[model samples]
Target: MTAVTAPEPAEQAKEGEGSLRSSAMRGGIYLVVRQGLNVFLKLIGVMLITRVLGPTEYGAYVAAFNVYLYSTLIGQAGVGVYLLRHPGEVPDLAVRTCYALLALLGIGLMLGLEASRGLLTGWTGVPGYGPVMAVMALALPFKLITIPPTIALERALNYKRVATIEIGGDTAYYFVAVPLALTGTGAMSLAVSLVLRELLFFVLAHYYVGHGPRFGFDGRTAKSVIRYAGTFSFANWVWQARMLVNPLIVGPVAGQHAVGIVGMTVGILEMLSIIKTIAWRLSVSVLGRVQSDFEKIRRAVTEGMELQIIAVGSLLLGFAWFGGIAVPLVFGARWAPVMQLYPYVALAYLAIAAFNIHSAVMSVIDRNTDLGLCYVVHILLLGLGTWLGVRHFGMIGYGFGEMLALLAYGLVHWALARRIGSPDYRLAGLWFVAAALGLFWRQLGWWTIPLPFLALATPASVRRIRRILEQIRKPRRAEARA
Candidate 1:
């Protein structure tokens, strides 16, 4: 959908201020509620699986699944995301071909994983990861079930639909998987439960987005999505490499137990990320609608980034402060060790929040090649750091290396932003301070605390947040008689 150009800068500023704020606030709320549900489900799922199968088996399952997760991203399924930012001639047709290509790519990934099954297991020591990899191979094609549809919906600013699917799908995974683990099925049960969960979600996504993945491939549409997909392929490759860096290094060097610990911390780190992702998706879609209008895109990009840094940083700070004491109290004592590792990995989340502004800027400009280049630099630093870090050091080394890698990722954005002459210290500096403090001290939590100040700042930020809530709550007024 083409966004209507604002009549002038002042008028557009007023219009954008209200519109972007409303959209982000709405999207953030949907995600917050959905994340709350997902976190609940995750706790239940982890508790059941860990307690039932025990840590050793649970560790094996976590290790096996990450292998699949890493490889799938290696497919660089980022084109769909890029499409959301830089939409073109036809949305439906563009999305149609995107799905077709992914199906093909998914097939190739599955086969490649199968071909090296024996070697992969020997490397990971998860034993039977070969078959788990087989199930994971199914993720790409079946993924056609939801990803494209969700992207289209986000481009439409229909995040409520996304909220529904995530909450509902997560519930499905919990209800189904928790029961299976309870039944004494072991690690394989967790894998089967996950695959089944995706299949169920694929079916449900249809109800919200109309017909699901169609068998017929459209050549013209295929050609269209591929151009953007190629860009996505690069952006996603870097992103995936960053994600896989830990698992790749930790598994071989640290051992199965350490892999499990890292994985659990990753889950906790996601507590805040899940919401930011929804914000990122919304911003990409909204930004796409306004890119040609430089003024609008600029305002949208800046405000969106500021809002995200504030929100995400606050959440992370709060979690880092309390997680040390809270994790064991809530999830049981078995989780106590994980709490120690969390405060450090939180740096990655902070860096992501800080650099995310540049990521938004990059996607809007369609300069995805920069992403691939950045990943190359990041990977080299990460590998060297992780090698020595994991060898002579321990989880502390692994987490510290990750913190620096993420810090460097943000610094990359600062460099890019400076080149454009629109460098953002509110985003970069604020996140940097938060990460530094969170890693060393607890004072950063003040930024998110003070419910009264959020209450106060809402008024100056735009309309007060309470007033916005009132608009959402109040019934519509009836028209006066003509």
Candidate 2:
């Protein structure tokens, strides 16, 4: 019998690298497909729910929901990110410590929300806000507990399973909320639907993870996890404060109706920017695997910038072009403010899309302090601008505030460039300018309509498109040869 030879370490590493890239590509495609379905479901659901609830009721829901959302951040504590980006196999002790930390924080947040419900209601001044908040707060622990198992899957690049669990939970929410909203349940319909979604997620996440709660305390493990978690969470907290600005600042200054308008506009933009979400999640996994290679990370960011702007810019332009006619016709004139707010928010999201990979890279390389500083400048600019603008401009002020905050992205660029070299922003910049002009066409007029198309038809853009196609095909060609 001939003796079998084992593969060398270098060969083994090469195979492992190939497997990771293959898994990331497959996961990315699954997530894209999943988001496409989610977009459809959410579009239908938002149309129905917004029509039924209108601005006043929806505004109330938005306010309470924002409060609940901000509270959940406290419970998250960045444990999932730590787990996902851990260099190699995470220790069981670390996982258990994560579980214990999450549980304690989850319970603490739930109780805190319960205790502050009345105060929150009084502050927002939305009728029945306390009750709605009370209901939403119950989901905090369930939401937090689901993170560990969810991270377990993410670490393995099992996005197919993750997508299924998420879609199921989302479907449950719409099915539960739409009927209830049509029956005049008002804001409570959403609150109830949210609770159900979290419960379903908790169940499904654990089931697929194939494990029960395992809690333990290792002093060293706990210390390491908490050390990372603290920095990550603090940066996240500052970043998430942007969401709270709507409820805390706009709601108080311009009434809940304005809050509803801003909220709806933001929700729609988020739906359209679905690719950013998918890319960011995938980047944490993909980049972590290659974190030691600064050149690879830099290339990823450059390519990501070009591709993201192309993907999201078209959607934003389309919406900016047709949303005015569509919104009033489909959802009624009460939502007309959405069009006024759309361009500003769309511009912010566009800029974010181009630079989002920078943030992901920073996180992967453990540059939380730089990220935190960037976030601080962003939120400060946003908060101060919104407070001033809303006090002066009323409903449109939030949009103005978002525009002003776009300046802070310079900080992100600077911080990221300091670490991994600057990404090539030429293609992304061209697309951004083109999309910006198109988005503001209401002000710039019909002459600007052809500018975006012309930009894309340029020689550079055409070559870049061809290059991207080749990159996509190269993998398949390699697989075929193998």
Clashes of 1: 0
lDDT of 2 by residue, 1-482 (tens): 01112234465487786666666888999899889989989988988999999998999889888888888887888888888877566777778888888899999999998999878777876776788888998999999989988888887678899999999999999999999999999999999999999999999988887776677778897788778877888778888888888888898888888889999999999999989999999998888767889999988999999999889999999999899998987777889989988999899999889988998999988998889999999998999899999999997888888899999999999999998888888888888899888899998899888988999999999999999998887767767787
Q: Write the per-residue lDDT of candidate 1 for residues 154-184, one digit (tens) a residue.
A: 6555668887887777787777777888887
**TM-scores for all predictions:** 0.82, 0.96
| Model 1 spans > 4 angstroms off | 1-24, 86-93, 217-220, 293-302, 426-431, 442-482
Q: What is the lDDT, from 0 to 100, of the residue 469 in candidate 2?
A: 90
Number of clashing residue pairs in every model? 0, 0
Whole-model lDDT per candidate: 0.64, 0.87
TM-score of 1: 0.82
lDDT of 2 at 317: 90
